[model samples]
Target: MNDHPHQSSSLTAQAGLPSELNQHNRRADDSAWIEVVQHMDSIYADLVHYQVELEEKNSALEDAQLFIQSVISSISDILIVCNINGEIQQVNHALEEIIGKTAEELLDKPISSLFCEQHLSLIAEFPEHIRSGSLIDCQIELISSEQKEIPMAINCCARFDHENRLSGMVVTGRPLGELRKAYSALHQAHEKLKTANLQLIQSEKMASLGRLVAGVAHELNNPISFLYANMHALKNYQQKFKTYIDAVHVNTSHDELQKLRSQLRIDAMMDDINPLVEGSVEGAERVSEIVQNLRKFTTPQEQKKQSFNLILVIKRAISWVLKAAKTSPEVIHNYPAELNIISNEGYVHQILINLIQNAIDAMDHRGQSKLVITVNKNDDSVQLHIHDNGPGIKQQNLVKIFDPFFTTRTVGSGTGLGLYISYGLATEQCQGDLTVSNHKDGGAEFILSLPLEAGK
Candidate 1:
């Protein structure tokens, strides 16, 4: 009966144990669920923080982009972006403002189309320049929507991608109207300064020449006067001797006369004395004429307009040149005997002397020299040609022959001032033109054209 009771109690305890275990298992499950909920809440909070941070970063990126656009739009210089093919891809507001065209209209157009002819031609070289990674500053002209041309100075550089590959170009332009105007003014000023310098140099040359001529004339005056006086005295003595000889009596002994003639050497003296005296007189007169000519050259030339024989002046110049050169080259004067022109005689003389002397010098260099002078007269002007059979001037040096201090002769053999002064006298003083060229034959020909009534 005790074993029965113990078994019943064990069953009861087992039933109570089931209930107790059920309660304990429920509490453990609740604790585990609470921990799982806490872990999920923590994960949700971290995700929310990440989303908020991402949104803030996106907003900052947008602001930076907007700031760059504003800066590019506000800039006054035209900013252009072109693709590798030089096609316009983007342009700033400044470009639209300058050309009065919207970016939409220019988006696919060629960048070269906006440039003028000259700059358009340079488009073919743009790729090479870009390839070299060089910045080019070019003067270009831009055409506006209304067809107005605007000058600009553009600075262009190549653009590259993040991978360092050429993608496009960036160009900035500035208006160049004011700069071009400034440059033009500077160029004109430089030309004026050059002209003034040439005039000053010419003035100095004339002044020096005047001083030299004055000194030479002063020195020659005394000698020429003495020579002239002595010549006249010798002539008078010859005349007296002739009278005395004529007064000799006819009854004089032949032997006595023969002895007198032998003692005096009368025949030989008579044959030589007159020519010697004539030559001396002629030389003195020539010296006197040269002195006068020198004085005329130095003195202030008055435009004392008068009618004078041109042929006579030419002959006088030729004579003076022949005397100075001491060589008789054939000079053919093809002109009217008494062609007269109204001008300053002294200046004309100066011109002819210079031309003739140049011709003579040229002839001096040749084995067989010839000079042919021809004159042509029309109602308005006269043209004189001095042609010589000497080596012609080089084609390269022809243009510079009249420039001051330009010469091909040895240093002391020629003063380069001759042709320059001749040109100046012909153009400025005589109101004429002097030009030179090689003749058909192997020689140089100088043509001088003068208005009949210069200064009229």
Candidate 2:
């Protein structure tokens, strides 16, 4: 009985050991299954993130394609994108409409097919030329859908890829007919502008002349009256001489002849004749000079320039302007006796007259008005400075002083083109410059610079 109980106890222990081993193996397998599940979850998360990024990139790509299409469609000039082999890869709407073909019909076609037979050789050479440098404004003939030849000015440049290699050519063209029309319209506008400018200048000149008419009349009257008085005195002296000679010829007594001579004042008349004649001649010459100056100012500017005495011109301009001026400003001349230059004399005269007139106008109502004119010589140019002791030009007005029709004068008192025209004539016609500024001593100063030689 004791041996049987020991055997049973041994069997129970072995059975218990197998049961513990199975439980440990089951726990270890559960842990491994949890680890596998975690790894799968991590991989799934990465796949979802990658998918979202791909969608965003696809959206951006779509936007870029739409933008490119819109730009290509909106271009007015015909555009063609070709491969390196000169085969058309893409084209704009303008090209489609101009060639009367759809993109589907034109794609992959040889570039030579779009051009006329005569231009095929030139079009072939374009690729070679484009490799070296771009082809600009090359005139060529294109073949339309109806096989009609159309003239075009085309520019071709090599298209580059991301690697900076020339992958293809991009050609843009405009119709020659449209270009010619544009040029014609521009030319017409330019001509009209020139005509209007000329009209303005002439109108201003006439206005200036009109303003000076009273002064000119008064100027003419002085010499004329002097001439008339001298002529009258000469006539009376002639009559006296005639009477005395007739008495002598009639054989009157010498005493009676001497009495007649005394009554006629013959000795005094002889003494006065030479001086009166000289005065009359001087008066006539003065009248002639005034008339000549007036004529020059009135005449249209000559095409050919001439060498003239600038000092004399300034003096004449001053005389003309001062005569018409309501106020008498003391003019100080700070220049040599004469300065000669080669230019349009009439233009210079007009410019000086306008400047001087402006100065005089500025000095109106001012006390003790003074004008100082100075000339300075340079190596290749001459500068004339006209300064006036009057209310200086406002800082704001200085910049706009040369603008057309800009004025500070009362209504109808001025046309405001005087300075503008003067500036234009100085800079454009004479190849010179004119500027204005406030003087240090309190006045407006105008500086005019002229080149010594004529502009070619």
Candidate 3:
């Protein structure tokens, strides 16, 4: 051991003494040191590898988390997460802004409290969709802190856990207040349309009634003329009676006067009571009938359907037109059998009055006025034809005849809404068709076809 530069290092080889032993000792010693050094190098390399790989994995995970958060905050709509029990777990700032409530206040509160009475039941149904893992798109109203209601369309989807249990829901809300406003505007427009339609019908009815009144006045003329003539006769008889009385007074009853009084029953000629009573009663009855027709025509009876004599309505319509026009428009009605068409009698009269009056007006610019009306029936329908020997409609204007506010007459003389309303009633309500055309016979004819028994 003392022979070497370091006695301890050489001592072991000196003890071996032989060449092979010394070489063996050196080899064993070198091998042992080399193995130790190699083990240390391998351990160092493993530590370096683990450190770099861990750092790279950590950076990747951080990037992924950042990407998720970016997506969550970037969207426009309100994003909310709710548990299956309907408690808000998380909500974005947009939802908080809309509700005017912080996420702190929303947590643990039932999601239903934010909705009004109308949406309460709807919200209750959301859990069903959540449990079924179904998506629901519904329009709902959210009550805000300021007491203002906000409409939203909730697009909700189910979120499940690892075990497939209903864990929560993810909902994205889209504002619907503007859409609601649009729908409301549409509804108001619809109501306005209804009002306009009703007004059209009322205007048509008034025009018809005016014409009917004129006709009734004309119809009363015959009875009035007869009554006046009868009264004149009565006056003459009175004068004769007075003369006989005077004769009796002057001559103490001349034989001729006395004989005449006895033969003619002059004793019963006290103011001609019998003729006066009969004529007055008859004339009063006629006036009453005419007045009744006018009343019925003007009545708002279209609200209820009724069965009435179609012939009576036609008569009233003719009377009204004739009375109002007060012209020599020769109107001829050719009808067979009595008609009892069941419908709104008022509107029936309205349609007829419009057609007849329009016919008269068409002839107003002409010298010779003539009209022909024909009423005929088939097995299930009635046909009414009104013809006027007036200037026929021009080819260009035929299509626009039924348009509202379109008139050929001078301003203030016609409203132009007549044919439009009449056409509507005859076709839409009466289940009938009304059309105008130039007849082969030279005049214009307005034809109305209506069902006799059943109506639309």
Candidate 4:
């Protein structure tokens, strides 16, 4: 009787529903609330994790910025950054040191203002061309705040935004004064080395001359001895003729005068006198030739290159070599009558003489020894091949033949420098080449190819 509508419905629901059903519904509600609370807790934890990750990333970005600033400040090279309008936007401390201007003073200024007036055009064109993403390196002079000029080598590159549009240019420059000084030092060192090498070559030549002096002395002695002997016989003949003439003037008996003339053997002596005079003259001439050649080979002369007949040089070399040679190896010349080469004549003579002597020594007791020298001309070059008829070089020794102080002869018999010196003379002084190989038929063959033009 006391129930209102809402109270009546409440009372009915409570009475109609089972107690287990109510408890089961309550348990379901508790389970759903627990799930909602757990999901909220999980979302809170995830939010905290995300916040920490963002903080770490921000820290890393700040470190990277600091690192880049440090690099730009501490680097010695001048660093400059400009906007597309060619106005200075940023520059490193090195730029300030180079131009003697603060960053604030340089900002918004045209990049060309820092360059020399003549070099301004290069700066003007650089920005436009840098848009094509090309790096350009050029030498330019920059006018400092104090009006002093500083030469620099600058490497310029374009800076682009993520969309690939050019935003600005980054230029790095380095002073060239130190580089130039380094180059000068290197050049001086090179000159010194070249001079030292020439001295060494000269010393080697002296050593070669020393080895041949004994043979040269012997060569001179032969002519001198013959000339001296002929002079003695001429004096004796003169004395005998004077005695016969005096006997005739004294009005001696015909028999005594005849005896005096016969004692001198005047008729027979007259026949031999002409031959003795000729022999003496020839001996004197031979002595003169020997002295002249020795001087030509041993005298120190300037390294002046000139054009001359190679045939004459060969003949002179052959003559000198024949004087010192133990055996006369027949030389066969197959060159042009007047082949000309532009090089140092003395050095060429030395090389040929060494070659001829070596060829003679290789023949030993081998019968039918010959040194066949053939010179042929090609375009721009002349090749001289010296072929020897003797035992060819061993295959194993061929590779080491050109090395200095490498030889097959006995210690007392060779200095091991003849071929080495010849090779250096041809390749270094004359800009030519010397090579050796075994002859197909027999013996060793040396081929020397020289340029017809000096210093070719």
Best by TM-score: 2
TM-score per prediction, in order, is 0.43, 0.47, 0.38, 0.42
The residue ranges of model 3 lying beyond 4 angstroms of the native Cα positions read 1-73, 77-353, 367-370, 394-406, 415-433, 438-443, 452-456
**Candidate 2 local accuracy as lDDT?**
0.84
TM-score of candidate 4 to 2 decimals: 0.42
Query: With candidate 4 superimposed using the best TM-score fit, by how many Å does residue 293's alpha carbon deviate from the native?
Result: 14
Candidate 4 has an lDDT of 0.82
Model with the higher TM-score, candidate 2 or 3 = 2
Candidate 3, position 215, lDDT: 48
Candidate 2 collision pairs: none
* TM-score, cand. 1 vs. native: 0.43
3 against 4, candidate with superior TM-score:
4
Residue pairs with colliding backbones in model 1 are: none
- Model 2 residue runs over 4 Å out of place are 1-28, 212-456
The 0-to-1 C-alpha lDDT of every candidate, in the order given, reads 0.78, 0.84, 0.77, 0.82
Number of the predicted model whose lDDT against the real structure is largest: 2
Residue 273: error of model 3 in Å?
A: 19
Which consecutive 10 residues in model 3 have the weakest lDDT in total?
Answer: 1-10
Residue 212, candidate 2: Cα error in Å is 4.4
Model 4 regions more than 4 Å off: 1-302
Question: Per-residue lDDT for 1-456 in model 3, tens only?
Answer: 223334544886667688777777677667667777999999999999999999999999999988976887677788888888888887777888888999899887787887777888878888896677667998888889998888888898888789988788888887896567889999999999999999999998897765555445545654465566667768877787787778777776477887878766786776467856675665566667557755765673544567788887787677656645647687787985478877767667768877887888889878888898899899888899999999888889889999866789898767676788788778877888999998887878899998886444
Query: CA RMSD for every model?
Result: 23.6, 12.3, 16.3, 13.6
